[model samples]
Structure formats: C-alpha cells, structure tokens
Target: TLSLFYCMVGVVLVTGGSGLVGNGIREALGKHETGEEYDWVFLSSSDCDLRDKQAAVELFERMQPKFVIHCAASVGGLFKNMKNKLTMYQDNMDINRNVLAACHHMKVQKLVSVLTTCIFPDSIEYPFESSQLHDGAPHPSNEGYAYAKRMLEVESRLYREQFGHNFVCAVPSNIYGKYDNFHLEDGHVVPCLIYQAYLAKKSGQTLKVLGSGAPLRQFVYSIDVGLLLIWMLFNYNDEEPLILTSNEEISIGDLAQLIVNAWGGNIEIQTFILPTAFNLKYNAVRFQQS
Candidate 1:
C-alpha cells in the first residue's frame, strides 16, 4: 500500500509555532543530522487566530497542509491559572473547537494535538499510563484548563471512531526547556525560577518562589516530547493516546535545585511557605506513573 517513491513529507501547519512545544518540534524535525527536513508553516497568535471561525477557514483554504500539529492553548503556572479560570477555559476551549472544526472542514490528512498532564487527575497511578487518564478528577486548581483538554481528547477520539480520521492526541507530562516562557508574570516554574533567580543574583537581592516547595511535578524536556510527537505521527496509526513522558517525579524544592544546578551552579533559589494544599502534595506524581 506504500511506495518507495514517497519522499516528500506533507506540509506542516503548526499552531502556536512561537510557543515552546511548537518550536521544539520544529527544531527536532529540522535538525541537520538525522531528523528529515520537511516543509513547515508557522502561525503565531496574530497570523491566524483560531478563535475566529472565518480566519481559521481562510487559513485552512490557503495552504491546506496535509498535516496539522496543534500546540496552542492558554496555559501557565498555578497562580495565574487559579486566578483566571474563565480566561483559561474559554481561550483554550475556543482554540481547540475552532481549529479542529477547520481541520475537519479542510479534511487535513492527519493532526497531532498536545494535552497537559494536569488533566490526568490528582490520584494518578504511579508511572502514569495512558489508560489511567480517566481514573480520577483533575486537580481543582487547574480543573478548568483540564476540562478543556479532556474535551479535546474526546473530540479527537470521536473523529477517529466515526470518520476514520487520524486525529492523534498526546498527553505529555510537565514540559520545560529552552524557549520556555520566561516572563515574570507569564512563565512557568522552570523559566520563571531560573530567570528570576539569575536576575536576583545579578542585582544582589533575595529571590522567592510561590510555594512551600512541596508540590509534586514530573517534568519532561520539551524536545523529548516533540520527538515523541513526530515519532508517533510517522511510525504508528495511533490506536491509543501516547504520553510523551518519563516516570520521573521531583519535588518543587528539588526541582528548584535542579534549575539552580542547570543554571550552572551560580544562583541561590528560595521558597516561602504558602498556605496552598497544592504544595503539600509534593512527590504525589511519583506513584502516578510508576
């Protein structure tokens, strides 16, 4: 059913190409040594807003990429998410609904959508498997965002089951690496901690993190997750949801230390005790994927 003459890879349309995961996938795919270079088109928040039905349709009609990789969503750390529930829910929900609807309209050959590990609930089994996704309710702090991602999973599943489509969904663990959001208000734990600490070190001031440093989180490097995405898209039919992660869990305190080490052992990182239950759950994810 396949031919050796098929050398040209499909044109790739990456939503949120400016974001960490999208950028990571691009680098992984375009690596000079081994990863085959493919034609790719990047769209940021401005180029084509998925929230607009007309714009999404117009963009889909123009390039008509045979493959679409959706890495776009409104996501951030616990503080921002807890404060802005409606924004997170509405923004992420709109993006997925409009984009997936456009893909169905354009009939793109295949799609790869990324979801967060936060959607997998608090009582996650150790070494969390893809099968345990539906085991428990999501963490309350991020329940809104998690609900949107779960809806994404369901929509993609329906497409595959009813229409025989290739809408692949990947649920990756907490991801971090280069190009991660480093903004003081917008960045996640790793970038925020590293950059803020580096600044504090340079300015000779005290640095503080939000929690008591007890929250359990599992982190995967962005590129590793990207590689897993492309691998599943190319090599498999994607019968089940694939998780781009390792079962390694780390405490918020220890994670801070890792960044301090990765920051080349130059900065001091400190955490202040917060009254949040999220912090008391450190190492909770250790048994989640084990």
Candidate 2:
C-alpha cells in the first residue's frame, strides 16, 4: 500500500507558473477531460523566490511533485540581456541550477526545460537541426541568455547519461499571444511591437522599429508552445534538444506591419540600419490543441 501510494499520479509543481509557457502548460494539463485527476498549484510571483535555493528546496518538499515543469526564467528581449549581461547570465543560471538540484534530490518524476531559438548562433545552419546547438556561437544579443540556458541542456545530458534521471528539453521559437508581456524595456519582439503598435494608434503616430527590417523570424503562438511542452512531458524522454518553430518566415518590417494590422492600423516605418546576419532558419512547428 505504501509503495502504491508513492506511485499514485496526482498534482505537479510548475515553477515560473506565471510565465507564458508555464501558465499555458498548467492550463492545458489542469483541464484534462472528465475523470482525469491531477491538481495543480499555480504559483504566482508571490508564492516563493525560486532564486533562493532554500526556497526551492522547501517548495519541493511541500509539494512533493512527481513532475516539475521548470519554466521560471529571468527572460527578456535581446537588448535587456545585452545591457544587463552579468545579471542576466548569473540570475538565470542560479535559478535553473538551484531548481534542478532540488528536483533531482526530490526525485521528480520528470523535468521539462524550455529554451529559446535565440540560443543558436547568428549564423545558423539551414533547417536548424537539433545538432547545430553547439556549433558556432549564439547571437551576441542573446549570448548571455543562451549561455544560461545551455546549462540546462548540459545538466539534462549529464543527469541522463550518468544517473539515468528522467528529463526532456525543448528549444521553442518566438512565442506570442494572449498574456504575453508588453513591458517596453523587457518584452520580446512580438509583444514589444504589439504594445508599440497600440500606443502609436492612440498617439496617432508611426512606430519606430530598430535594426533592419530584413532579418527573418518565425512566430509561434502561445498555445503552440504549451502543446509542445506537454508533448515533451508525455512523448519525449531523451535529453536531446527539440525545436518548436512555426517556420512562417517574415521580415521584421513585415512582422511590424502584422502587429500594426493586429492593432488595426497601417503605419509607416522610418528607420535604417545595416542588416546583420541574424537570419532565421525556418523551423516548422504547427499550432496544437483541438
């Protein structure tokens, strides 16, 4: 009876439960159709500070979660990471390391870590096969963020290779949708443009986009990211990285227009900058959820 009790499926702990990815996954998992049983504690920013190792350990003990979806991150746009290099790198690294350590010791049924495609080098090889991860270097703007995430990839491999711990890793593409952050300084490209476009409409002015409009990017909706996270939890067991991209190629200029259109406006973009080699390698990930 005691052994069966330990094996019963129940609730799960989702760190960064407030983030776009975590929130999506929690909602999807929590909404399993009738008779499916699994409670979820959606921790807000107030529940605990994951940055503290003691707090992480304490949370793990209290929850005794069979599985942990570690989506908590000090993430942001390229500019923020580039500007606050030290803090960006150190904080993300520390939070991830502490959380994983706690998960390992607690014997979490499994752990799924989501990383960004930005972690790939500026000169990405076409098709962006999972193997190109360690090839060359990540874009400088995202280098710090990438470096911090690289640890999760490394640890997952080490844990599986040496200790046979269960873990899954994902490298998702540009994500955007409802509940996305729109903070002027820290938001990602889509949200930044969304906010900008809306504000420009209110102010009756054209929005200014930085860098060249030519660098291509892929945009995956929030729900898509959630589905992939859940899929990894159930279908994938390897430590190898998996990518999630819509592969809908669009220029920054076009993306800006889409945002403007999404905001119900036609705006002029008046900015000129040399096009850097930050090209996107079209990864085709479709939107999931029926």
Candidate 3:
C-alpha cells in the first residue's frame, strides 16, 4: 500500500516561478489534459533564498520533489548584463550550484535546467548545433553571464557522469510574453520596446531605438517555451542539451516596427553606438505537442 501510494503521487517543483518563463511553464502544466495527477510547487526567490545552500537543501528536503524545473537565475537585458557582469556571474553561479546540488542529493527523478542562446560562442556560425556549445568563448559583452550558464551544462554532465543523476539542460532562444521585466534600461528588447511604445503613444513622441536594428534574433513565445519544457521534462532524458528555438528570424528594426504598429506610434532609430555582434539563428526544433 505504501509503495502504491508513492507510485501514484509525484511533486513537481518549479523554481523562479514568478518570472516570465516560469509562469509560462506553470500555465502550460495547468492546461495539460492529465494535469490533475501531479503536485506542482512554484517557488520564487522570495519563497526561499536559493543562493543559500542550507536553505535550498531545507526546501528540497521538506518538499521531497520527484521533479524539478530549475528556472531560477539572475537575468537582465543586454545593457544590464554588460554593466553588471560580475554580479550576474556570481549570483547565477550560486543559484545553479545550490539547486543542482540539492536536486542530486534529493535524488529527484528529473531536473530540467533552463539556459539561453546567449551562452553560445560569439564567433559561432548560424543555425547553431548543440555540439558547438563549449567550442569557443562567448561574446565579451555578456561573457560573465554566458560562462555561468555554460557551467550549468558542464555541471549537469558531470553530475550525471559521476552520480548518475537525470540532470538535463534546455537551451531556449529569446523568450517574450506576459509577466516580463519592463524596466526601460534593464528589460529585454520586446518588453522594453513595448514599454517605450506605450510611453511614446501616451506622450505623443516618437519611440527611440538604440542600435542600427540590423542584428537578427529568434524570439520564441514564452508559452510555447513553457510547453516545450514540460515535454522535455517527461520525454527527454539525456545529457545532451536540447535547443528550443523557432526558425523565424526577425531584425531589430522589424521587431521595433511591430511594437510601434501595435501601439500605433512612429519610431526613431538612433545610433548611439555601433551594434554589437549578437546575431543568433537555430535549426528548427523537432518536437511539438499535438
């Protein structure tokens, strides 16, 4: 009877649950057809300071989660990452280390950690392959953050190799959707443009864009990323990192226009500085849920 009870029940823990990607995963899980069977726990930074190892261990021990979606990390926009490289590096390293260690110690059935395209080498070719992850150095603009995430992949593989843990990594492209950070200087492109457009429309001013708007990027919808994460949690069980990205590539200019058109405002392109080399392209991900 006790074994039957264990088999029938499972706890799913989602860290950084208040953020955009975390919220997306939680919402997708809610809409799943068989979602009623598992227990899901969403933990934001406020729930427990995961940067603290003892606190992370205490939380894991108390929850005894069989599944963990490790989404917690120190994230910011291009400028923020560039300016606060050290902080981003240290904070994310602490969070990832504590969470992954806890997951291994607790013997969680599976742990899917989220990563970003920014971790790829700055000089890597387009249509990025998973095999080229650690081939070269990442862009200098955000190397601190990139290397921190890069280590997650390394740590995941090492953990699995040594302890035989089911620790996997998911690499997603630029994600945009609801609950995103809208800070003018520290937010991602999409949310920041949206906010700028909103302000421009309200004040009857032309929206200003920072760069030449030539760099290309693939922005996956947060909800779509969430669904994919859920699928990966159950369907994917390997050490190789899964790249989750769309094939549609949009220039910064077009993306800004889209935002302006949505808000019914005109845009002004200002070349404050030369655009950095941050273009990203990916082969279409093969998985989908019908």
Better model by lDDT: candidate 1 vs candidate 3: 3
Tens digits of lDDT, candidate 3, 1-290: 63344345878889999999999987787666544578788999999998899999998888888899999998988889889999999999999999998998889989999998888988877777888999899998888899999999999999999999989999998999999999987888899989988887788777777777878889898888889888888889988899998888999888988888876556554444565757888876767466
**What stretches of model 1 exceed 4 Å from their correct place?**
1-9, 32-37, 262-268, 275-290
Error of 2 at 90 (Å): 0.6
Model 2: worst 10 consecutive residues (lDDT sum): 30-39
Local distance difference test scores for all models: 0.75, 0.76, 0.86
Q: Taking the tens digit of each residue's C-alpha lDDT, what string does model 2 give over 72-182?
A: 888887668778877988888988888888988888778888877777766756876777778878777767878889877888788878878897788887888777789
Evaluate model 2: give its lDDT.
0.76
Ranking by lDDT: 3, 2, 1
- TM-score of each prediction: 0.85, 0.90, 0.94
Sort by TM-score, top down from the best: 3, 2, 1
Q: Model 3 — which ten-residue stretch has the worst lDDT?
A: 264-273
For every candidate in turn, the CA RMSD to the true structure comes to 5.2, 3.1, 2.5
Top model by TM-score, which number? 3
